[model samples]
Target: MMLRVFVTLKPSVLDPQGMTIQKTLAGLGYSQVEEVRQGKYFEIRWAGDLSAREERDKVETIVARVLSNPVIEGYRIEWPQEIPA
Candidate 1:
């Protein structure tokens, strides 16, 4: 199975990179842009027999321990509807 993880800074945390990008966009004539928030995307492929619940648990552990910073970051997992042939 394939899984995707998205990690982003919590709303309360300041995002300097995002701000910079937003400013750049505005300078580039994208005046309508209000804000930009940056995040990380990870695609993982697991070939195991683990059940759905177990897989979720394992992925959550990985995300919490290594994929994202618990202090100021939040993460979510996505399961694609169709696997590539």
Candidate 2:
């Protein structure tokens, strides 16, 4: 199964990189742009026979322990859905 994790800074935290990008965009004539919050996305592929709940638990553990910093960042996990042929 494939999973995706998105990590981002907490709302109260200041994002200098995002601000810089926003300013650059404005300078580039993208005046309508308001704010940009940068984040990280991870795509993980796990091959196993684990059940859905088990897989979700494993991914959650990985996200909490390895992927994100609990103090300043937040993360969300997305489970893959089957695609019809």
Candidate 3:
């Protein structure tokens, strides 16, 4: 199975890097660009034979425990041909 993880700061948290990128874009004539937020992306390819439900459980656990900080960051996972709950 192939999975994608996206980790980003929560809306309540401040992102100085995103702010800097936005400001730089504006200065570079990207006037239409309003805001920017930086994030982390991870791709995982698993060769396990687990079913979808099992795979989801394992992946969610990994994401929650290792991939993201729960306090100030949020994460989303993309499962192969499926919508995450």
lDDT agreement of model 3 with the native: 0.87
Name model 1 segments beyond 4 Å from true.
80-85
lDDT of each: 0.86, 0.84, 0.87
* Candidate 2 lDDT over residue span 1-85, tens digit each: 7777899999999999999999999999999989999999999888853355676677788898899999999998776765211
Candidate 3 per-residue lDDT over residues 1-85, each given as its tens digit: 7778999999999999999999999999998989999999999997874356786788888998899999989999877764445
For residue 20, model 2's alpha carbon misses the true position, in angstroms, by 0.3
TM for every model, in the order presented, reads 0.87, 0.87, 0.87
Best model number under lDDT:
3
Q: Which ten residues in a row have the lowest lDDT in candidate 1?
A: 76-85
